[model samples]
Target: MTDPYERLRAEAEAGRVEEVVVAVPDLQGRLMGSRLSVPYFLEEAARGGFGACVYLLATDVEMDTGPGYAIDAWDSGFGDFVLRPDPATLRTVLPWDEGTALVLADAVWPAGPGGGHGPGHGPEHGPEPVAVAPRHVLRTQLDRLAARGLTAYAGTELEFLLFTASYREAWERRYTGLRPAARYNTDYSLQGLEEVEPVARRIRRAMTRAGLRMETARGECHPGQYEIVFRYDEAMATCDNHVLFKDGAKRIAAAEGASLTFMPKFDEGEGNSCHVHLSLRGTDGTPVLADPSAGDGMSELMRHFIAGQLACLPDLALLMAPNVNSYKRLQPGAFAPTGIAWGRDNRTCPIRVVGSGPSLRIEHRVPGGDANPYLAVAAAVAAGLYGIDNRLPLPPEHTANALADPAVPRLPATLTEALHRWEGSGIAAELFGKETVAHYARAARAELSAFERAVTDWERVRGFERL
Candidate 1:
């Protein structure tokens, strides 16, 4: 493949590319940006950066901005922050979107009058990285790992439910009585996947063409749920692709007259999950998480990394499970972790260590389909570093099912609990700066507040006659 910039330039000159999307991953991991003409993008936005409202980093999922966030968009009069395009993330749009290319960007403060130097600045001049930005938050942790001469690689396996109803139809009916793409549990059953295969196949092929290496696609335990895994890459790049794939998958599904959701728990049945697989390597690319001579084939670094997960799981739950509905999927028997424990290839534990030698890694099963990949991966990296720095001891693996183990530590059972743990946690404040912690805590508060005020169907149904 040719250099991304060169290829884009050539395509644009030949009239094959017309528009370029400049996007930044918001707090909810949604791509928020504008589509620019290819000529304008190549001439100006590519280097000087495009202006976006600062609230992109400060607002809730509904784009509502208010007080108490780290960025405090309202206090700042909702000014513009620069979206500096990351050339490495440049790629052609999906198969269905013709004549368009997309590039992810970093949220940064504009250069001041004098232009001072600081961390998270642009290449030629200084423009501070929005400290609370999701991408910047993840980048901070990666930088910490780099200082220790280590690099992190990760892959995310996301599960989502497909509905035969179009998005507009689903919205019109308030998402009830809709037909699932698959009518029965399709777990590894070829016969039940007929309805889902066409859309899934299209998504897989399009993602491969977009430069994401496909690993596996399979039917899951739920009636309409499916899981797609992509080959792991450098942690940041993996997250970049993760967001792009999610956004594109939804668009493609809509275009096909179907709708898909990555919500953690769309219904009372099996829920969607995003299991993250992470590992460490030396700066030179030597695998550092595995040891062939060790009795268990686990290196000392691997033990500390696992220990860090146990130590930080409580404080960092907000990053893994951020939304109100997220906790609905983390309940017992939901196949979404309910306890804090680690085990060898154990599906029941939150941290499952798998593979061996160079392929060895930990699969963090805590995050659900709705998690922000950048924040969740950052939490993992931060916890691992804490363990390594403190020489934290790895405990005995929970050989039994962790969910049913009464003695095992419990993860926050609700989003409110997670927010309380995060807001009051000194560990969270230390790992991520106090400001970053506060910013996300406020985001969680907003979610909880919204849920509190809404009058749900359950409430109406239970009270209309019975009460």
Candidate 2:
């Protein structure tokens, strides 16, 4: 792992790099920003950071304003938010514009008008970093883990469905009547993957060049859907790579004259998922979850962490599954977890404990394909840390099918219920910071409200014809 700035500088000096991009993940996990000529990026943005609209953090997926957010709005008049470049995230984005590299940013706001703002900029003192910003929220949780002499490591396995229609065509069709990349269920089917091999291979190569230790890329159970796997890394590193992986895949799809969606469900088909695998380590690099003496191969520390995640699963459900369609994928028979329980490598349980030795870890299967990588990790880590802090006890290992288990705790079934649970969660408030919780909760509720206000085809089909 060479310093990204140094690598970018070297590549630029060699005349191999032409463009540099400064991007920040918005509330919807979409990277929003502009491209800079390598010279300007190297001269100014690479060091001092760049200015972007404050609305990027305050808006919804459509970039429309939502009510009750504590941040910028029409009343306040949109202001500029600074993008502090993170040198660590600089990487090449291949198959994109020739000779292009990308870097993510930390959003910093002005302390006062023209008084110098954006972190690491201005006279001795300058702009303050927005603590509640998505990246900042993840950093806060990781920093907390480090301070306790523990290392948090995780990986995100993203599943998405590819469409034969190009992005423009998909848009023109309003995303309807599009065909899957493949016509049949292609779970582990190499021949089936051949249909999307070119697209999948291109995405995999880009991610590898950008530095994701890719584990596998294969078709899952559903048609048109595929999964890309990655080796686990430290929390921040894993998430940064996940964001790039996601962005790169979408870019590749658009370039290849195809389209896709990471949304939980695509109409009457199987759902996508962004399953996360996680574990903690000691400063000495020991697997903290492993205990040879324990029957289930989990130490007391690991049990407490699981207990914590279970306790907070409902509280953080909104962060995990943020959209209205998200809940549609959480129902039983989808192979998605509907109850809060742990099992030994069990796919039916919300928490799956796997590996008995050094690789011991917990897989949180609660999130849908649409979860924000940074916020999702933040929610899990914060809950695990809280569990450690409070010594929460693990519930009984759900040896039976969690879907049929009556005594097991059930997670929120709808976006509205999840929001209510999130609103009442003190752990979420404490872990994500009160301001971050309120802002995100407000945004989540707004999304729910908007969906509620709309009239859907289901309603029309049920009521329009007869009554």
User: Which structure among the candidates has the greatest lDDT?
Assistant: 1
Winning candidate number (TM-score) = 1
Q: lDDT per model, in order?
A: 0.92, 0.84
Question: Candidate 2, overall lDDT?
Answer: 0.84
Candidate 1, which segments miss by more than 4 Å at Cα?
1-4, 114-125
Residue-wise C-alpha lDDT for candidate 1, range 1-467, written one tens digit per residue: 75458878988888888999999999999999999998899889998999998888877888998998887777677678889999999996557688899999998888764222224444566688888989999999999999999999999999989999999999999999989999899987778988898889989999999889999999998887898899999999999999998998999899889999999998899999999999999999999999899998999999999999999999999999999999999999888899999999999999999998899999999999999999999999999999999999999998998999999999999999999999999989999999899999999999988999999999999999999
After the best TM-score superposition of candidate 2, give how far the Cα of residue 351 lies from its true spot, in angstroms. 0.7
Q: Quote each prediction's TM-score.
A: 0.97, 0.95
- Which residue segments of model 2 deviate by more than 4 Å? 1-4, 111-126
The clash count of every prediction, one per candidate, is 0, 2
Which residue pairs come into collision in candidate 1?
none
Cα distance off (Å), candidate 1, residue 144: 0.5
